[model samples]
Target chain A: MSPADPIQVHLVRECAQRTKYVIDLPEPLSLQAYQELADNLPGILSSVFLPSGDVLLQIKLLEKEGSITGSTNSATLHVLLTKEGHGRLLEHILQELRNQ
Target chain B: MIDIREKVQFVPHLDCGSLILGGEPHVIHCHYYNHFLQTSIEDADGIYPAEQVLVGTAQEIGHSQFRKLFQEKGIQDERERKSFVEVVYSLLGMGKVSLENVSAEGGEISTPYEHYAYTYAATFPPRPKGKRGVAYFSQGYLAGAIEAICDLPLGSMGSRQTACLTQGDPAVSWEFFRLREPLPLQPSVGEGRYQTASLPQPPHTRVPFQAIRDAVLGLPLGPDPETGLIEAFDVVLTRLPGNYYALISERHFQHMLSAIGPDVIPLVLDMLVESGHVCAFNTLGGIMCSAEWDAVVRPYLDNPADWLYGIVALMPALGWGIVEPLTYPSSHSWTVSLHNWYETTAIAALPNGHTLTYSPFAEGIMNGILALVYQAGIAEKRLTFDGELYGSLFRTGRTYQSTFHQSRLQGAPTDVVEGHVAR
Candidate 1:
């Protein structure tokens, strides 16, 4: 869960099963970053998610303000890890972000 | 002056609209008799009476006496002044000057020959490096030409027509159409036929010139975030004399697509298209379809995971080509036979192993599988694309089946005897 490899392949798969959105992170994300991503929800008009630890996650919006309004037509989310989810294995990271 | 006896008296009536001005030896009594006559009507609404409106009797009976008395008391109290300037020619002496015909109408004058020269000159193409014909002429030259014509002492307002012919037919005017890029010629082969409706011919009306000009003068203009747009262009529409109008603001144009919505947007798009105002449709990104597209596909388009699914459903609705016979070529790639040209949309996979698509019509099969893989990866707590197979493409959409089958026939070479190249 470093910035260099923020999004792991496992997270994308997990996101697809639990929710309609499948977001992959390329780098470790921060809580503040996740909030900022959520704020852009109106423009993206699509569902977005950020895995925070194993049980908590953040959401963002997609498909918002159109071309005329200068919106980029995208929604980006960042997920961060909590102390409990730290592990050499990605399973620990998944456990931290998942609600269960 | 005549004096009245103290014993003389007058009767007072409250309902009567009359006023007594004085109580001296001579009493001046004013009566609004017409007002009383009109007041009796049920629907008079407290307006002046009809009798009072007539000039002969009610006027004489109510206020004529006062006029006569005033005239008797005034004599020779005003004087007139001579204010006319006289002009004399050398040949004429002792000629009386009179105010013959004083008119209030103003006029305009023009120089047509000069305009004609400029226009005629413009008929010839410009030199390779210099500005166009009219533009090549210095501002001062144009100004001098204008001053010379308007300076004509004997010219009539129609002289302006002469100036127009002389200077040039206005090749460019405030009313010229403004567009950053040219429009598409015809709907792309599979693109839906945008319905067109006749808009009110742009009103041949003009706003007050000064008011419109003043609206932008010294005003603080800037991008407003609340409107979610940027300033882009401005124009003035002039269809009447002595009237100028601001037809547009660049800032407003920025958000026009979303603001106008589907119903009225097509009218403008039609105009732009017909006029060659938008040059190209370069990218498949952005929300190009009208709100109708959103309304019809809202349930599916909103989820990133269903991006491909949603797009497949909308293809037929959009009248764009459909994706059919989606065959997975490999674990990470899929092949789709499109009913129409596929340049309008495409999809790609992100470095994070999640699939991202930019198809305005439908998310391809490959992107859907990528979505599944990404979801599985998240659940497994590993950012991996290991199980993602591109070749196992799933076919969707009833429209795709027909389109796919049709494409097979249409794309086949006539001379092909078997499943080999025609050659």
Candidate 2:
């Protein structure tokens, strides 16, 4: 979470027909941080709020690339985010990084 | 929704009749149709057969337009198609149309009443008071468009304006329902005649103002100025050309007044009042002296109802409003309301959308006509504004109200006739 130990983010091509970006997180953050990310992701991705208080992410096709990689002491996992999903994930990461 | 800016270009179509500015040919001119068609429908008493024909024609036209737009645009995608329809509706001033649960079968479409052409048309002359949904043309247009867009069999698709502006609804809602059987074909009554034809032709031959002035001066005074005035007007009405009404359109008349400026309007109106009195007295006197006076006119004078219809029929040909009987709330008076007035229509058509100054010419004529028809003395004749659009003509024995709403679209310096008739 320090300035020197920044989260790694890179653009990558999934195939000849498609391209995406990958984000490698420094650590599996606290549950509270994850919760905050989930809450703010919708507003970051789509400005409109649904009746159920959920936001539908509207991302352009070009922004749909990449996956979010989270690692712990024992294991690593990757979650694919659409363009809008990528936006929400990045916003959450920036917020957590700023807090640290 | 596909951005229209990316998908289409709007160049003005060469043909004036085509409502579609650009895109492939699918001409639909709802505005023109709304103005003229509604005028006809109003004239025809808003008959069901006329309504049915309008609906049928609209649907046919909708089918052709939709077919062309869909085909030329290659709009097979559902979202794009919906967007296309909405854009088309918005462009045509049908309001921003939205479809829900739309499929090959049918859907619910909704639009704000503000965009409906009928919302504006309903306000036109002979404005409907407390009437049900009068957006007959819009209803048909939607139905026809949907049937074509969905490729529904003719008459299988039915659309109704569930909510209408005329009914005080904020938005017009239409439910598209499938009919078990095709709609029964009704004999087509040709499009009703447009009121544009009824517009007064400009007076090519002018009547010299001096001649009228001299005629007024030379009118022989009888027992009193009132009696002599009536005799003079009767002579003018009888000997004047059939197109004497055309003189009201004389530019020289208006130009002369304009040259005199607004100061002369009152003086001119005072002259009109005297002329009105003269015309009324003449009419009554002529009827009294007629060969059939004892048999026909006398009975009507004795019983107001007997002669009312004859007077009503004669008034419109003389460029007046339709007269309907109104029950007199008081025992002492008889009352009738004039509907679909020609004067307000003419005035409303002037100066484009703005109002014109009030002219006492029509009012005076109405007063004169009412006084004679009711067999009331000049002193007993009275005219009063009911609302900006309506006026009531009252005589001592009977009352007549004009249903025509005065043209609010025109500008006037001051009201020519105000307050109750001066005692």
Candidate 3:
């Protein structure tokens, strides 16, 4: 809930090994946090730094909607686009934010 | 403690080639189609009264449907009726809701599983305002169900989604209350005027319509016992009311034509039709490449072009209508006719039958069927579907197109959709 608290991630829809997920940031992701996620993304995921200061992700990771909640109203970044892996990519997103 | 799922039945009107549930036709469509069509209507928010059109259509259909269901079952108890509404809502894979304290006067109800909100949030990634309470369909649907349960006159009740789980809330919630002034609603034409003739059986086609239809219907297309969501054919499925789709699309077309003028015709028509393309590309393509297709319908695909026959045969089972191929197997340069197709039927049922031309949904499907059967490489199971795939296949490259020779709503013998070769 705090600005420095770790983000919450939830799975949305997964089909044909492709997925969609949300990583709730109570506060908007700092540029550094976005950068850290991009840098730390699994090799399967190729990240493109968007001009709008958001990251657009393509599922190089090949993978997965569930009841999604806990995203804040600040802004929805193309942040940590997790759609191709199991829950690990989402866990990676949350853990990396915690490390940050 | 009756088993709820077992209670719901999709009776086959094989002669008409339709599935009737709770006295209304139902069709199986995926999230892509639902999301696309819903957003298309939502996109015209300011241009027209989009919310009114969307919510009102749902409320109207839901009211008509529940009223019949309650009578058929003789469900007299208020609590039993409420429980019945919730069960059917989930049974159809719309999403599960807690109608725990919901009633006719007004009430607040929430669920993590409402279809529209959850799917919308999943489809579009995080946005600044956070998309909340997008369950407009549920808003109107539950409202109508309550009114029927209470035996209230149509439009006596109204509902609004207050919070959406997709919006970061723990659940999607709605506030239902008596409308200060009841809406003058159009009674839902439960089943439209459909021409009944023997289904077209082209002599050369190897796939027999009756055989495939019976097999496809036998497949378990029901919702998960727990989540009440159907994840089949590689897409989340919903047994959506046939009238809900008919009312929204036809109403939107009418609104655009009247308010925006004829100059907007080409643009609006193209956009509306694209939802069908999205359905065929994703839903149809997904089915062709699915294991279920291999098990049930695949054996009938005796020839390369028979894929078209095999797929169309399953249309009725999905409650779309009786799809008869006027032209034989080859994908391109063929014509398909629809009898009692939900879109046209729903529209004709409208008082003073509206003139919306050929159904955009059918046109898109006609074009998409060809593309999926031939272009997407589904025969080889080499489909690589994504957001980009639609563009590459439909918007660009050598793309297919459909020309509507006749429209059922326009007093044609039947709805005819002809597919032309790629441009």
Best by lDDT: 3
User: Candidate 1, A42: how far from true, in Å?
Assistant: 17
Residues B351-414, model 3: lDDT tens digits: 8767477798888898888887777765654455676677877888647888889887777888
Arrange candidates, best TM-score first.
Answer: 3, 2, 1
Model 2 residue B65 lDDT? 55
lDDT string for model 2 (A1-100, tens) is 4446456544322211222333345554443444454354322222222222322222221233432322122111223343433456655645654564
Candidate 1 vs candidate 3: the TM-score winner is 3
Chain A accuracy of model 1 expressed as TM-score: 0.28
Q: Per model, how much of the real contact set is kept? A: 0.06, 0.00, 0.04
Indicate the docking level reached by candidate 2. Answer: incorrect
- In model 2, state the lDDT of residue B76: 71
Candidate with better DockQ, 1 vs 2 = 1
- For A1-100, candidate 1 gives per-residue lDDT tens digits of 4556544332221111111112244333444443444453222222222111121222322332111110122122222221222233234323333321
Displacement of residue A20 (Cα, Å) in model 1 is 23
How far out, in Å, is residue A30 in model 2? Answer: 63
- Model 3 spans with C-alpha error above 4 angstroms: A1-84, A87-100, B1-4, B127-132
